[model samples]
Target: MSQFAGLAVELEESGVKHEMITYSGAPHAFTVFGSDRYREDADKKSWMAFTGFLEEKTGVKAM
Candidate 1:
């Protein structure tokens, strides 16, 4: 199994609520919008995922 799959298995065994995402070709710092390493697709997707998680868990909508 792939690394992410293995991690999913581990999380399942540990009974933890979790989510996993991978950016296929995104470089490091992909979330830093103005940085040279930024990747627009990954950044936007990740930000949306992050905000969704935050709102779900804390009930605070992202601005």
Candidate 2:
């Protein structure tokens, strides 16, 4: 999580709005389709968070 933490700090210093999520026990590429580490809960959570972030940045609601 050090990498994520460093990025978060950089984003904070840059004053950019962002979101970071860390799913415990989730491997890299957990969201990749057909991967053994794919997690439904993580996918759903990340999707919603991403959509919300997009909506915030673009001022366009996701359908």
My TM-score estimates for the predictions, one after another, are 0.70, 0.68
The alpha-carbon lDDT assigned to residue 42 of candidate 2 equals: 83
What's the number of clashes in each of the models? 0, 0
How close is each model in CA RMSD to the real structure? 2.3, 2.4
Provide the overall lDDT of each model, using Cα atoms, as 2-decimal numbers: 0.87, 0.87
lDDT of 1 by residue, 2-63 (tens): 87799999999999998778887897788786888989989888889999999998999999
How many Å off is the CA of 27 in candidate 1?
A: 3.4
Q: Which 10 consecutive residues of model 1 have the lowest summed lDDT?
A: 24-33
How far residue 29's Cα lies from its native spot in candidate 2, in Å, is 0.7
